[model samples]
Target: MKIHEICFSPTGGTKRVSSMLSRALTDETVEVDLTAREVDFGQVELSPEEVALIAVPSYSGRVPTVAAARLAAMHGNGARAVLLCVYGNRAYEDTLVELRDKASGAGFKVIAAVAAVAEHSIARQYAAGRPDAEDEAMLRSFAARIRRKIDDGGLDEPVIPGNRPYRKAAGAGIVPKATRACVKCGLCAAKCPVGAIDAKEPARVDKKRCISCMRCVAVCPHHARRVNRLLLALVGRMLKKACSQRKACELYL
Candidate 1:
């Protein structure tokens, strides 16, 4: 069986988690970057024998809208799917359920689900260095179980967590901006998943379209992209209680 790792990871946390799980899950694999702008997301086809590992980071307890759109547009053609939701130490409230629904709607047979923690995208102090050694072990174990189930021709539907009407998407108002250090290289605009940045003027951000996923900041060569420091600090402080304790990776098969 082949594996397709489809993910929308802006700051590398989700990509890291997906890659590790994909590695442990199957040998033959290809990555379908959800961030790519040129590809016709709906046209990517997968055979029934293929397994799609669909993952996205939780943005305020919901699927990132743009990512969800791309995923919903894809045609999975009865391929089995493993859904994953990665979050800051806070919570992955409705991300898994939303993803499962989208994958199933796109024609994949939903088989398993996972909720994993990684360093907070914005609130870095929480769950820092995670999907660390401990997470890796648990993910590998989950993969072993998944492999056995597949090997045994088990096609049971896995139950995932979340609500019907998902919580309103929050934490997206504060868009990052380029600093004086920005040399207008245009890389940020080129890499923006939603094409929210000004292509001709890289430093100017289109806030209406920006999802505050921090992809520009993560890819900026000059370290010039950032959001309001005070806002960031305030958010970090607010999350202190929910994120103070380390959360474990959860797998539902």
Candidate 2:
């Protein structure tokens, strides 16, 4: 069966985890990049015979608004969906449940769910080097189990965890700024998912438009874009205990 791999991974961790699962499930697949601004997600339609691997990073314990909106616009057409929520080893909180709701609203039949750990997007120290070798093996195992269920035609929705009213989304307070080392390449501006960075003046950021997803920082060739040092340090300290222990990936079938 054809697989539609829909993912919104700002710093690459979420995509890394999803890739392992998707590769194990099927060799033939189509990728839907939820981060691309040019793609009209409303035009993305899937047949009932197809399977959708919808993956997204947990931002402040919830799915990113842009990703959710884009996903909701798609026409799932009763496709079976396997939802995956990647987090920074802290906690996915309501990410998986929220994702499942969105996918179901788009007409996808929820079949399985996964909660996986990845390196923290902002504070790199947390869950560093994750979706690592261990994560890959575990994710592939999850895929194998999911594949079996699908092949057997058992399509009941798993008991996804989370509250009906998802946790309120936090604002974009950790906007990345370009340093003096910036060379005006405008790569960050072009790659920004929300067009927050000004293309003409690369250093100028429209904070209101930015979602603090860190796409600009991750894509900058010069590595000049950075969040405020004091703020980052504070956040690191806040997440230290929660992210210290190595969290195992979870599967719900």
Segments in model 2 whose C-alpha atoms lie over 4 Å from true places: none
Q: What is candidate 2's lDDT per residue for 1-253, written digit by digit as tens?
A: 7789999998899999888889999998899999999999999999998899999999999999999999999999999999999999999899999999899999999999999998899999999899799888898889889999999998899998898799999998998888998999989888888888889898899988899999888988888999999999999999999989999999999
Model 1: pairs clashing at backbone N, Cα or C within 3 Å: none
Q: In lDDT terms, which candidate is top? A: 2
Predicted candidate 1 versus true structure: per-residue lDDT over 1-253, tens digit per residue: 6789999999999999998899998888899999998889979888888889999999999999999999989889999888989999999999998898888989999888999998888878898898899899999999999988888877898888899998877746878888999999899999999999997888777778889898999999999998789999998999999999888999999
| TM-score for predicted model 1 compared with the true structure | 0.98
Off-target runs (Cα >4 Å) in candidate 1 are: none
Cα TM-score per model: 0.98, 0.98
